[model samples]
Target: MSVAELKERHMAATETLNSLRERLKERRLQLLDTDVAGYARAQGKTAVALGPMDLVCCRILQGHTGKVYSLDWTPEKNRIVSASQDGRLIVWNALTSQKTHAIKLPCAWVMTCAFSPTGQSVACGGLDSICSIFNLSSPLDKDGNIPVSRTLTGHKGYVSACQYLPDDDSRLITASGDQTCVLWDISTGLRASVFGGEFQSGHTADVLSVSINGANSRVFVSGSCDGTARLWDMRVASRAVRTFHGHDGDVNSVRFFPDGNRFGSGSDDGTCRLFDIRTGHQLQVYPHPQDNSTPTVTSIAFSVSGRLLFAGYSNGDCFVWDTLLAEVVLNLGSLQNSHEGRVSCLGLSADGSALCTGSYDTSLKIWAFGGHRTVI
Candidate 1:
């Protein structure tokens, strides 16, 4: 190596370090001069100032060998549960990037998983048509498998999604390919009520997603391949209160708005729609550009403030939409180190600080806002 070239490189490194040190000094000075709480209050008033495009790829959680189909962040925002086609359910400590539990499933085709509201347990189901619950606090069996505390088996088809009721782990809702959504009594492992499947009150195709109302727990909604979303009441499970229609393709995912007065649905048609539960009106529609082909919308989640909508696409793209503007605010797929295969599912941490996306690439990526750093 030439001495001149080495000296040039050394000078460049030194210049970069000095630049960084200057920036740090400026930041420290700004912190010292600013009113911290007032600044924080101002920041909190604007929910999510930085869009997904502004977010750096903070963590790529790699472990699953096959496509990760589903993931859920516990309400505590400290843990995540993911179910993969590799026949495993992984419980992750979100802060530390450590696996707390890696359970071997009895079946390999697992589709969905959800953590209880209290974060005490996890439930998952798939092509086996069974909803299995695992007590996270229980000791593992000698084989290192977490023993299943109960298995609810009444679904006639693959269980597509499962979620515990808000503030109540004793009950859960499960959507199925059988065109029905069931409310289950988790304590007894019995069916509480079947929400659909009858000629007059159910989806004509598979029920793909369900979202229980956070405000009024008795009411919940389901999205279906029938291209419709139905609102149902737990007290009257035999019939739907309203049937929402607009999508031309299968409704793949559904999620309640933070207020619970309305819900959103993502469809294979590459559009996400919002519907009002009371008026039964189609409130808004978010569609991909007409200039290019669209990818199927695989999953959707709402930010805690309901100001943003996160939609995962089959082409490995995750779009963040401004709820008020109804336009794509950011495309995570265009970013470096983004998912390489179809994005199968996505979810937001309870605190709304982190967004998680799972993909056919057999990995998950956690994206956080400007100041938060997830433990590696």
Candidate 2:
């Protein structure tokens, strides 16, 4: 090769190298600068104060006496309900964080629970392969007391996730270990439709999680052990709106942003992805550290402020990533002595006033959010 050609190639290589270095440094800054708890320390110990991980944990609801599997907050924000291995659903006051009610179930273990959009009832799905709904308010005495509602069954395996159609409390949907997602007429306790015909349905394997887009009430998404996430329209007949295929491992979670056009997924492959729902094109892929260490992404949440994304990893560490720049916001901390074991679930209030996490440690931890929100 001529000297001139060799020199040109070298310059191109140098430019590429410099660009990559700049991106790496940004990830590092995301790791350091975005640390939520670290910045809180700079301020006095108050509304925005707590020990790195330990102090941040508030009101461990200790009633299950077993691993808490699923939980949901009432739409009114007045109560939160949790399902556990003990086969019970316990209700708590949202503010005081005090237990208010508990109900024993006929099932073996409860896998999922959800609140009706109006906050008047709740549904619990379990290993017994049935979904149960309860009324938050019923024929009260002279004062005011809630009553047990009814049970809806049909799935043959464990129910993984249950979501109610947006703006409607009379209907609901659930994804299951039976490899199908079902829509139910909650008012009549009848199956409205069996999604995904009968051949192990749309998902390649057991469906793990499901989330509905509130902006477009008729659409929802689900992720599965088979390594893909599918979007379905409630108005259609088991037709997949989009199928996302890129993860090298099982997909555990999928959710839509409040805006409704885009969604995100987290997998056992140690990566979180954001995609455009219309064209089935992946817009961006956010990766875990190169160590990729243990490869289990426990939980993920979009900050209420829309400025950040939070994910809990298998190694007991949590990270915050900025959504706009696709940068890491901070390394929250490890679960070590904090939650007991891996963090399995996280919840953020509608107003984004507080955060809650459930883990194998058999407890729930709540974190206070204190970030400034600006319209972008």
Instruction: Tell me how many residue pairs clash in candidate 1.
Output: 0
Residue 268 error for model 1, in Å?
Answer: 0.3
Error (Å) of candidate 1 at residue 255 is 0.5
Clashing pairs in 1: none
* TM-score against truth, every candidate: 0.84, 0.78
- In lDDT terms, which candidate is top? 1
lDDT of 1 by residue, 147-203 (tens): 999999999999999999999989999999999999999999999899888747789
**Model 2 TM-score, all chains together:** 0.78
lDDT scores of the candidates, listed in order: 0.87, 0.72
| Candidate 1 Cα lDDT to native | 0.87
Error (Å) of candidate 2 at residue 340 is 2.4
